[model samples]
Target: MRIYLPATVTELGDPDGLVARVVHAVTPALRAALPDEDEEGLEFAAQLLAADDSLDLLGERPDAPLRRVVVAADVPQEAVAPLADDDAAPSAVRLLTAVPWSDVACAHVDEVAAAEDVTAALAGDEDAADRLADRDLLWFDVGELARLAAGHE
Candidate 1:
């Protein structure tokens, strides 16, 4: 159950704090989304910690435009599939699994990207929005995210 936790780092605030907030926001979402699971929370937390370690190892700048935390564990595969389908708002955070894209097969991903682009453009960052539009990047799989998410009590 590899999970891809995509996050954005903006110039408005602290990157590390933002990451922590994202983690806090996501933990409960994951738990609610997978009610049958008991240890998912701990596993996800550990995976996030490992992701932080990897980032430190790579000497990644905290201010990078986009930062992703990969979490792997044995949680339910369905728990993370909806992230690719999120398209409601710019600040909408998503958690997705590494399963094939054909599973959800909706315009969710495109819609989300479009919304983000529009938001960026409206904020006078058309260049950034354009860059986002031109690319077909889909953040997938958090390496061992699923495995890590399922290992906790």
Candidate 2:
């Protein structure tokens, strides 16, 4: 169940805080969407967050407002595909808004990469274990992402 959560950067105040908050916000949504999810699913989500640095890929676009939070879980690829599909379940990646905790504006990214990076990161985090596991979600603050994209110039 690889899931990519694209949230308004405002929800994430700083880079370090991004990961945890993202996890908190996305987990419940995912759980609600797939209530039957097990421990393996949770671990997979956590692994994805720890592995990839979403800030690096978005680039340094000054006008870009939101920070993208990427999450991945180990589920059948078929199950995840429809969620990521452009035409189906458009709201699969639940959106959170007007969060006072965030310091940035908007977060955006390529849905495919978000999903791939999250899955790869999670898989690597688990050391490519075969067993299904639950893990924390990955979060990248938009402020930090923008800064990183700007090369801290």
Candidate 3:
């Protein structure tokens, strides 16, 4: 299955060995939520999942205004499993297998311009969340993950 996992540079690795995790998007639940939507719409829903995850990241690190980081990966269906979290978003799932760095194919992050709005959204401003939602996450090649993650590492 191809899942988009919301990640941080620190999770990507700092001192060399950190297994990326699965607060990933694009899961069965998300598909179920919008059965009639096209693939593009589905992908957008996954991005929304990532947006929510980014707020989670803010909760963990109150000072970070960095854009949300989402890494797109391809792992076997068996590798991506459900987590026991009734409170979690429908797209939320667990990654049962370790994601080899090679499995990460691309990334989605906030545009630099979205930083201030993201900060406001992180602070619980609902309107800011809407504004932030309007901003698309920028894409980059997988190789740039290191440099990108390094910012927080």
Q: Give the top-scoring candidate (lDDT).
A: 3
Candidate 3 residue pairs in backbone clash:
9-149
Q: TM-scores, in order shown?
A: 0.23, 0.25, 0.83
For model 2, how does the per-residue alpha-carbon lDDT over 72-130 read when each residue is reduced to its tens digit? 32233333222234442322432232222243333333322244443443446444222
Q: Looking at model 2, which ten-residue stretch has the lowest summed lDDT?
A: 128-137
Stretches off by above 4 angstroms in model 2 are: 1-4, 7-37, 40-96, 100-143
What candidate 1 gets wrong by more than 4 Å, as runs, is 1-4, 8-62, 65-75, 78-123, 136-153
lDDT of 1 by residue, 37-134 (tens): 56755444434443333333223443433322332223354443232334322212333323232221111012133445534544568585465445
* Local distance difference test, each candidate: 0.34, 0.36, 0.71
Of the candidates shown, which would achieve the greatest TM-score relative to the real structure?
Answer: 3
Whichever of 1 and 3 has more lDDT, that candidate is: 3
Question: Stretches of candidate 3 above 4 Å error?
Answer: 13-20, 63-65, 151-153
Residue 142 in model 3: lDDT = 71
